[model samples]
Target chain A: MNKSIIELKDIKRNFKVGNEIVHALRGVSFTVREGEFVTIMGTSGSGKSTLLNILGCLDTPTSGEYLLDGVPVRAMGKNERARLRNHKIGFVFQSYNLLAKTTAVENVELPLMYNSRISASERKGRAVNALTAVGLGDRLMHKSNQMSGGQMQRVAIARALVNDPAVILADEATGNLDTRTSFEILVLFQKLHAEGRTIIFVTHNPEIAQYSSRNIVLRDGQIKEDKVNEHILSAAGALAALPVPAED
Target chain B: MNGTNLFKIALRALNNNKTRAFLTMLGIIIGVASVITMLAIGQGSKKSIQAQIAEMGSNMIMIHPGADMRGGVRQDPSAMQTLKLEDYYNIRDEGKYISAISPSVNSSGQLIYGSHNAPSTIYGVSQDYLTIRQLSVEDGDMFTDQDIQTSAKVCIVGKTVVDNLFPGGGDPVGKVIRFNSIPFRITGVLKSKGYNSMGMDQDDVILAPYTTIMKRILAITYLQGINCSAITEDMTDQAIEDITSILRRNHKLKEDADDDFTIRSQQELSSMMNSTTDLMTILLACIAGISLVVGGIGIMNIMYVSVTERTREIGLRMSVGARGIDILSQFLIEAILISVTGGVIGVILGVGASFAVKYIAHWPIFIQGWSVMLSFIVCTVTGIFFGWYPAKKAAALDPIEAIRYE
Candidate 1:
């Protein structure tokens, strides 16, 4: 019964390649409601990146009626789209694209810096809160290169959450981590979702869909299947089940 | 984003690569420093030359017999006897702009006192010659008008002549010095003036009444030249015009005929020297300015490299909600900070170098306030002009491609 946070009707994206047109996305339809954890799954060349770009407001559909938080995005200008991206959506990349040599809190404060309404003190407070929420309070002062991959990913998540966007768009947020760290990050995501935050997790790995409330699988630029999971798995339980590695 | 935040961002980026930033600024530093130093030296020399001219009587004018074709052969002005004592008297009586006037004739010969002798020129002139030439008697007295009226053998000796004719450093006054076998009693000694920039020894001269040279030594009725002083430096032209008319009237020259005399003023010499110095100043500044432009290119080069190196960072910032203008201003601000900071340091170094040159090289140096201000404005403009393309390149980058750049 929650309001739709994202709506897409027959979205299509075409690319021109050396005198030929390539259809990247063909007539896709989907809606993500508030507080839903939706996992988008596809193989390589399955148009998941193009779909992610569209969902993140980085790229527009060639033809579609797309709405983000009830605002029609088809007619928006580039700058307006950038503003929309800043105010409504937060992005987390697979590589954890944090500024080099910057501290964790500073990385988290990056998103809020663009918002003129947020004062410096308020930005710092919000960044602190976000880092604490992601369980990185003790690591707030650690530089990006100083932290482990999982910790860096946590900082990226904190950055995403700092703006309090309507939806957090994550592109393989845990792809670079080891099994235990990936599960740990997944547990953090589930925790955030339980707190009523909307998230759209884009991944090529099918195993990640079991942890989310809904799944949309794509193949060759078209939707192969779309389903709501009957039961969501607990990432913390999965982490506990793995055998612990011996310390060096 | 606000300018302060952008400035901080720019500062932080520069801080990350301190060595590269400082190296890039070195070009501007050398450029600005050399510019200031060269200008100071140029201006300093020009001022010193003007002071020397002023000291020699700024309002002084000289009239010499003109070169003319006599019997189908061009004759030297010094060889011509066109300037006469009658012309001198006429200008003295009728010229309104003249403050002082004197007829001049000289006899170059060996001067001797006992066993000492030196080759020098004895200038025969009225007492007004001393005032017109800015000469002051350091000791004894100047000759009286009675000496000229009677054509008495009295003369003043300059320092060099005194030194040569009285090598014992004894007083030359009341001593008799023989000029070309003609003996004359010394009435005064001129104060010493050392060698000028042109290496001319001003102190090596003798002065006596023109009538003494014309009637007693040279045995001629025509005068060689006339020296006059205008009422003021600004009245030199009017004085020359007045003297020219009087001389023409005395000579009874036709209306369209050229004069048999040439008139020259210290103002004209001063202007000629000034033009020469100004040309040198401009040439030095132009050479210095080339290095500044090269320095600006250095800034552009580094900015381009910086933009390329931070492509991913730019993408991340754009991803985080920074607009294109924000990215542009950030890089532009960084370039500006580098140039302006270097400019300030250059100003300090330049001033220090000017003083160093003055003390160490013994060269005159004068620092103008306008040079410093000019460097500041030039460096700022250089930052904007050179930094623009690179910053624009950074701003116009596609966020997706930039983020994924290897």
Candidate 2:
């Protein structure tokens, strides 16, 4: 049995919105083992965003125990949490948040700047490898604004993987892409998952959830379903079966 | 993150938007330039005045006859002639730290030599007047003691007088020049000293013996003023004290009675001019310093806008393991870089402007090293001081909210 990299026990989050207590997340418990590709599915009001924040260590749960790689992260200070995020986790946002006008390789090198042990040469090598892993080796000097949305997303993935973290937390990783580009990104995710990297993907679309090894559904601030995916789909096979646009 | 990396990031960000960075630096550049240039002008004028006064002699002192306090009005010192030749001789023989002494009297008259004529002041002074007043003769010789004893009508002409009375460039030495219808033989031609700080032509006078002026020209027994030099510049006060005591004893004034002479020293002239120039320098600096404050505010304004505009960028950096202090330092470094770069350019421009004023505008300008260093330090401080609030606001931002900011 694989050891769990992320374990959440009885997590609760509350927000005071104009004098009324809105329960964003209520007693949500889940464990993500190492090397598993898990998809968290929910609607806009389902508290999945709150849960993702807690998992990414960007926010602390009001009442819960969060063990990230067996270290208690919820009790850590601000600086300690930053350290944990640098070494233990990586983030992929839907907006492909690469600095505009910055080259691809330099964008990939951003996270390693916060890592002290890595030398400049080592950081460059790691950045090149991460970008190559996402099939952007030839576009090393391409600026994000100068590249397509799909290419920009790949650069963001390279940034997330540069630190070789224990977990990758992606929120709507392919939400901004078209059908074909989304499938291509999902294929890249499958490849990273095959390389034994733990990924927690959050999406509102059920179609994206079919690619994960495990599927989680949240409703009314609680988990409605936490089950293994019985019929795992291949994003690459899906991409290949679709008809290419004539303009492309 | 380390400072090097943080600075590199800031430099890169600035390099990306070259125009915006330069525009921001313009304020500091103008501010520093104005401050240095103004100070240079004031300093240069002060130095020139000091030099002119030193030419008059730093260790020298003058004794002028006391003013006539008549009832409710006081007449000028030149109208009174209470000093006598006996008092001048007594101070010369008995005063300590005395190096040179001369009795001086003056009268203005139209000078005529051959066909050329000029109106000039004829100064009555002894042979010691040349060395005590730092005067040198370009031709012939100064009047002698025998001429003073015999009351001879011999005069030494200055450069302006020579140029005016002998326009043909002929030697005026050994020639007779008529002063108020009296023929006086010219003994020497003084060197040209040019214009003084007050714009007065310094070389527009003639020197004669005091005995000739008192016995022959004006026929007066009293003296106008006594000019004396101290052995050294530092001993001028003691020299003045000694001269005052000797003159009071020789004149036989009562214990509580005031002396009938007033004293003037070269130091007084220098210090009075120094204070005036110092006031001008401070006023100029204060006015220019206002622009510096405005420049600092410009940096603050831009940095604040930068923090607001780069909210998502801040979020991304925070998520990638950058601490609050790290974000703060990055923004702070950006501000410092702008101001410091501006300061350097401002110094270059200010020094250039000083030279330009000195050469092109014909204005005196001295650029002190301390002024440049002071403005440079001010620019750096302005960068950090004004950058603090914006950087703090950026550092205190919530990472989650910042990432979500549009």
Candidate 3:
């Protein structure tokens, strides 16, 4: 019923391999409303990654229109597109993509650096608040290499949430995490989604897709199935089951 | 794109690779040091020459015959064939500022005293020539006007000729020495003067009265040259003008015609030598400056490689909303830091090296403030010019591709 936050109409993307053109995406169309928790499912080479890149404004589609809110993405210049990517979209990669030498708080503060409107001290304060929200309050000063896989992912999530972007586009965010850690990340995503944030998760794992409200399966360069799932896990329910720590 | 952030990032990046950064700065260091040291040496020599020339009497001027001959033909006036003794007297009488005037006649020949014989120059001059040249007798009396009028065979012997002829013996004054088979009594022993700035031996000549040299030693001679002095240094130009007018009137030369002879003052010679040496020093410094440019190119090459190596980092920054100008500013700041740091170090080393050359090697060295500032400016410019293209390439990188780059 609400206006679509993202709209892609007959989008296509192609890659050149030597002299031959490889179609990464072919005439795909989709729309995501605000506060929607969606998952795109596909095996390797299914163009799910390419779709995520376009959604994040990191790359342009070869043809067709991609409109974020209302502005046509393909028509934006390099700097304008970068601004869009910085302020409108947040990305989570498979490897966490945390700067190795930087602290968790600094990693989250990166997006705020590009926003000239925010003062440096204010940006740092916001970054700290984002880290606290991700349950990384105690580990804000810890570096990526010092933290565990799950903690690093939380930091990456905090980084995604720092700029208060309209949407978070994640590509196989838990690909390197263990089963237990992946579940923990999924629980965090659910909590973020419940807080009125739009999330798009791209992964091949069926278990990961079960956490989202909607699922889209891609085969080769086209979508094979698009459906809504009513049985999505709730972060509050999951958190209530975990053991609570005693007050210091 | 703010300056503070850019500088912080650049400094951090350079700090990350300490060894590579230092090595990159080495080129500028060597270039600046070489330029400064070479220029110092050249300037030092020039200053030393000027000082030596200043020590020679400032008012002294030399007039050589046929000096204005353009090609190979003589350009003297018809009547100028005789630069007579009477003409010298007339010029002395006419010029107000004229302190002394001497006609010089010289020939190179072997001088013998007992078994020791040394080849040397014989100069025939009046008593005024000694005062003009700032030469004084050490032990015996000098030639006087009476000596010139009487055509006496008295002479002044230089230290070198004395050492060669009279080894460790007594003073050679009053001793008779044969100069080219002509016997002359030694009247005075000139005080020791090592050499002129041009490396000419000033202490290896014989001096005698001009009339005696003209009539007795080198017979049938007009005049080889004339040496004159002004009462004061400031009056040198006026004295030269007065002498020129007197000579022109005596020679009956028209105003349009060029003078037959050349008059050179010691001050003029000093200045000319100074400028020549200054030019030579600057030229050497410029050649050395080329090395700094080469060093800058080295920095550029390394920066390009660094950009390629850190493509992923560039992409990460771009994704975080860093503008191309921010990236450019960061890399450029890095380059300038390296060059400026190297320049500061190079200036220290250059000045130190110059002092080392001066004290240890005993060579004259002069280092100017302008040279140091110039080297610093050169170093900074080199960094920016050399680092521009690589920084531009880094800024232009595609975020998606760069992030994905293995």
Isolated chain B TM-score per model: 0.96, 0.96, 0.86
**Which regions of candidate 1 are displaced past 4 Å?**
none
lDDT of 1 by residue, A113-155 (tens): 7777888899899999999999999998998889999999999
Q: Where's the lowest-lDDT run of ten residues in candidate 1 chain B?
A: B1-10
Estimate how well candidate 3 is docked, as a DockQ score: 0.38
> Model 2, DockQ value?
0.76
lDDT of each: 0.90, 0.91, 0.85
* TM-score, structure 3 vs. true: 0.82
Residues A23-55, candidate 2: write the lDDT tens digits: 999999999999999999999999999998888
- In model 2, pairs of residues that clash are none
The total of clashing pairs for model 3 equals 0
Per-model TM-score versus the true fold: 0.95, 0.97, 0.82
Strongest candidate by TM-score: 2
Model 2 chain B lowest lDDT segment of ten? B1-10
**A163 Cα displacement, candidate 2 (Å):** 0.9
Indicate the docking level reached by candidate 2.
medium
On DockQ, who's better, 1 or 2? 2
